[model samples]
Target: MSEEQLNFDFFAELSEPVPEPAPVKENVDGADEISVEPAALSEAAAKAESSPETERGVTPFVLRQAVLGYLAGQQPTAVGIRVPTRVKKFQVSMAACWIAPQSKQNHIEKVVAIDIFDRREHCLPDCAEREELLATLKTLKLEKLKLEKVIRENEPELKDSDDLFEEFQSYDYSASRNTAYHKLLKQISRLQHVIYKGSRMELIRQAAVADYLYLAVPAGELAPEELADGWGLLHVFPDRQVKVVKVASRQQCNEEGRRHLALNIAATSLKSVLFANGVAVDEHLRVSFQPPPRRRRKRL
Candidate 1:
């Protein structure tokens, strides 16, 4: 792509007028509701501004704010944050819905998936140190297993002791050993983060929830090729400005998938409102209102 094409202005494209399709009457509830485009972006920006900055500087929350602003300027029908995708256990960071002019049915227009790299993940140790760390972690796991077995074997003997300190001392392990085990675990966690690269893009592709998919990252953090084929690249700057590094190619989404994505966005939007009003949603999708605790008044 040329420089102009690479730096495409998505908002300008969205603002351009397109021929409206023939109106067809459809029995869809809430089809005539006003678009929540600007309000959603404002809410997202407010939360991002209220949050403290991360150690590495620009946080995922800030990036989300920029992307939402970008989407809002384009005038989508509705926008949602952390929206669940059609794929189980996977969600897009942000999704925008657009209504089809002909049928007036809501469909997902854009989906953005963000990937933030933490300092530990970015500053992973060299290959030699990584191998050593893995080896140490393995040794620590074996030692932990042996210690657990010893504790289980001595459980009968310790059952008679009522003193907690005495029972802790009987475990035949030093405090330093416990500390080292936890340290190794932390290192292993960072190692896993470095190893599992592009996992976000993989999930976005698997979800395949929108007509246009975008991979958003902190400015100067990713190359255009880092995104999957047909996916767009959005660079979110520290000042909360969004730039389209690469335009996304339209993907085929059946009507069923579009409707499902739109429904997920609607559910997420509703849940946000309910939570704001002190209502809770359970795992089974049942909602309950919880009143705030009453404060006792002090008498003069």
Candidate 2:
């Protein structure tokens, strides 16, 4: 009886199906359900370790393209060009999209100045704790991205290391469980007290003088108090998706200053587009102008 009982269902229970694990709980932002594996986290960590300690900034010219796209959507007739402005005696320039008058009746020009946030110059908090956390979260996110990239690049190798191949997985998924990535994301999302002093005073000038003012910044990155002083916010993504969070308010365009800026903007633009257009300055008035085409003498 003892021998039969011992041998009875030891093999039988193994043959029966096993129960599946319960579903994971998800949070509003879906960070709580983070599912990155340790291999990915390790790869991300490696990437973060290897990357330069440079702070994230609006160094990407691609963001301007997103702003340009938005301008095209809003003012399909407008054209973008980098233009210079005088801010407290400093000749600082920024990109501007200009929409010329369609009819002579209105006779007013439209200028949209784009203020690109540079994390290197902007987005630092006076509070050391906020600054440190912001930097830490960025590093963590970069590491997470690297981990994802490494996993994708070595999918075959990972698959070959599955337990079915008489080996444990090379990737240790337990370490990077949801808590880690989600916590980092939460920290980043909750960042505050990061003040950016107008990126440039020219931004304020643009708001007062420009027909439109647009703030173009990287996706998910923002200052504590964005330069939302009636400026439109364009959150540009790597995928080229632009989200317009606020509509720009049109201010009274400065007639004299705008004309001066417009001519300079047009001349600056022509240098790029017109296959090397030279800028000419009038000495007496200190005004800039494009040279008129030279007149050819008749040949005998």
Candidate 3:
């Protein structure tokens, strides 16, 4: 071939890219080949797509678990592992009981209770409101009787007067009483809520009086003043590290109350609360507290 022709052939070969292999097609009686595009996802991509990411949080449940683990990992009488505990009070939810000196199993050395924020409204009226309501009812009763007397004396037969008399005679204070009762209940609920939110120290004080060493977390602002007397604060960190802000040692604990907590903890399984964070406890504890494997419901 001439030099120019040889150069032309080389340039053509370089300019035309090498063709890639087409997807293999079925060879059936010279049938028309149908194209099928390959998936873009690689092996890793497929695996990743198959499983979605799980949600994470440092919620109170999580913090409590961390505290449980931290405490459980301790040595004797040294804030050791959390024993099964229960809430004796209807209002309090989280609680724990630890035996003292690691010797006596029956005696409860410490009772730790966490007071979380409760937004549930109360339903009851204040004393002043109740007194005012009573006075108002008394006034309405007198006015109703006086109006009835005037109507009876006048013997008015007008439609409006008749309605007024009938209403007075058939006046069912039950409805009014019911309305007032509900309002009072709402007031009470509000009072309870306010007592819990603004002045939760009252509840904490009650616990202290009961001789329970109470510990609250995220350390509320008022906790310093209200709970400062006897209550302790637990400061939990993101890295699952629990720092005890204020250590409260109960000098005199309600033995019965502490026992009730222990019994309640003993009654409920750990999986319900502690393992709620997706972390499992030790094998022995798991066996003891772990819920029976939830039977998977068959899909219809």
Candidate 4:
């Protein structure tokens, strides 16, 4: 009650420091301890929302590229070119990256995410072409199957005693029929090319040099110098051909960088095939690059 005591107590209260808040534990592991470091929770949430699942066959990297490109009003082309490695270039599901039309629903199936390289756009050979090709193949396949069946049915008799074997051989129609059918099927198979317009990019064959440039070949046949990173190149050793292809980026390459690279490529070929649907870059293909035009000085 003393005036001195009241004055001292009031001053003590004024000088007392505020108690600190309890530390927050983010996880059971001490390593995950929460810090007071300032960060926007909404920013972290946005990142989580943006994170993509690569396991479900969706290339998160590619999808991101496509989304960004779309937002910028630039269309990115999909490349199905293959690489020899099994490395996961993008966080995506194998099915999404490998299968198409079926995995179209996958978010990664967009411009950058989709494999447009090995895509066979195959026009199903125009109705006329389809009808012609299918008819020949069906006919040849049917005859081959029939001949094979006939040979199997008469196998016992054909394998009879040695003396009868000679007589059986004399009357053998199976061998001749089989030969005919084989030849026919082979001919039909060649016609199968007529059935393939090539993948969608192929349909854009007109785009070759005109709009874009693409080559469909077994990854193996491709020269080492021609190979690009990130792509899984499947080569058939015997034929020296590339059987399957997909687009890939190098470890250091990011989606935006790749988009620029692709755009540059498209621009380079734009002058050549700008008017045609197809352009062939065969062994005889020759290209000579001219220096870019110089900028003139501005008048003062």
Candidate 5:
């Protein structure tokens, strides 16, 4: 079969709809919201058409499997998927370690973070914006405290607990304070979301306890400009082929970091094995194995 035909056959097996560019819409104020330009949208569509992975159904799971195979080929001493890093919130999609040739105790570790590139804006704030948002959140919290004080001062003194409850329900001050509290809460929640998304890169940097870091995505989905410096890029194809686009720069990993990475991989692998064996973990995190019931022999 021709290479082109083979490639087509591979993509035909998978079924996933390619994401379309979001249409521009006017806000409630009648102002046009910023969105992808017509030319950029058309260019993205053309690129997606040429790439079988994007055209077909190349999900994150499929891309992860391809990267796993590629990692296996490197013949690392140990490898794991969905491995937790030092930071609890962030996880390395794939992690591997190689034993140093000269030193049995030494290991060279590597980690990869995988993400699908969607054209939609994440609405993550820049450093200056994040600081401003944090300051606003702090101010709002202080204001909420002051409002709470006002509610307390306005509270009607009732000798009996029953009368206190009845009086509190009809208090105008309480009602007004409740409204202000909810408004402040909504603003705080929105700002928190923006801060979390904006801090993703920072979290990843803290989590990575490896000699090298890599970012993997579907071929043509990620742009070079989006990738962080010192990190490598791996392009996963629809045919389950992984191509290295950029070499990861080596980073310093102390003995502590290496040990931490190794322990995380081991713990994750142990959990996977226990689950595979049908070991049950209760809410308290106690593991127990239940043996299968033996079948009785039939008499002739």
Candidate 6:
């Protein structure tokens, strides 16, 4: 083919350039940003979408199983473990060290879940350690028996025994009038620990009958409605002097709330409070009570 004929063919081929398709538009407002496509969800995603798995719905049996399974892989003295699944969204669920009062089992495992489910809300478990409904009622009845025993022991003061109520205001009066009995209840409460079920939130307060107590709490999300007297529960319990209470209440608080309430009860009742921060007990668990340093008088 002649050079002129080849040049003409090349020019003819170059004349029909391919046209590029227009870029896809995401927002109708003429923004260059494209729409974010949702990721394809897996089975885990499907379960999450179907229903919220929080501490509330989690059973003690399931929690015990999970803790045992988890601990089997770790040290027996391990304090806590983070659960990746079976927790409410935007929450951290943990199983921590606890002791059962009924059995005096050391390092008893308990579950705790926390998030800001309700900003204004606070929760407290009634008592700790797993006791049957009848057992607890019977225990309360025993409190009555103890009170009667105290009255009988001090026979001369039976008429004024009712006045003992005035002196035991600081005690947890859920059962009896004796200061010793209230102290026993506090001990029982201290031994009691909280468990985070599958969907519930837990809270702890600085005071049992706090009008507006400082709280360390956990839940799914802290919403504004949960606040009680301008107190929003937050999760920042220290890892020492901590106890859990499995209190029997009309309603159950989530694990986090129960933890906070238990810690507060421990702090006020026992002169010290510790939190289970997923760390095993060590030298750090010991909290010493030191007197304030005396100031030296200025030399005249």
Q: What does candidate 5's lDDT look like per residue over 223-299, in tens digits?
A: 33244444566667777777665556556667678778877777778766766677878889987887544568999
- Candidate 1 residue-wise lDDT, 1-300, digit = tens: 234433345522221112222332322132223121111222332343455564537775676676777777766787787677765345666777777465665334443333233222231222333333334433444444444444445454543344455323333333333454455445434433342233444445556567777766666665543333456777766777677766676666666666777777777798667766788879998878897445689998
Better of 3 and 4 by lDDT: 3
Candidate 2 structure quality by residue, lDDT tens digits, 71-99: 55554333535455544222222444344
Off by over 4 Å in 2: 1-59, 75-80, 87-106, 118-199, 223-225, 276-300
Give me the overall lDDT of model 5.
0.51
Measured with C-alpha atoms, the lDDT of residue 135 in candidate 6 is 39
- The C-alpha lDDT values of all candidates are 0.52, 0.43, 0.38, 0.30, 0.51, 0.30
Candidate 6 structure quality by residue, lDDT tens digits, 1-300: 233321221101111112332332221221112222222213222333234333444332343343334334333222332222222231222322244444553322332322222111123212222233223323433453455455445543434443445432122234444676565444334222221111122222221221222222222323212222223233211111111111112223345544543343333322212332222334668554444445689999
lDDT of 2 at 258: 60
lDDT of 4 by residue, 139-187 (tens): 4444544654455465545432433333222223334435654564455
Instruction: State model 2's lDDT.
Output: 0.43
lDDT of 1 at 156: 41
A best-first ranking of the candidates according to their TM-score comes to 5, 1, 2, 3, 4, 6
Clashes of 1: 0
Q: Estimate each model's TM-score.
A: 0.49, 0.42, 0.36, 0.21, 0.49, 0.19
lDDT of 2 at 203: 39
lDDT of 1: 0.52
Instruction: Give me candidate 6's TM-score against the actual structure.
Output: 0.19
List the lowest-lDDT window of 10 residues for candidate 3: 9-18
Quote the lDDT for 187 in model 5: 55
Cα RMSD of predicted structure 2? 21.9
Off by over 4 Å in 5: 1-56, 101-198, 285-300
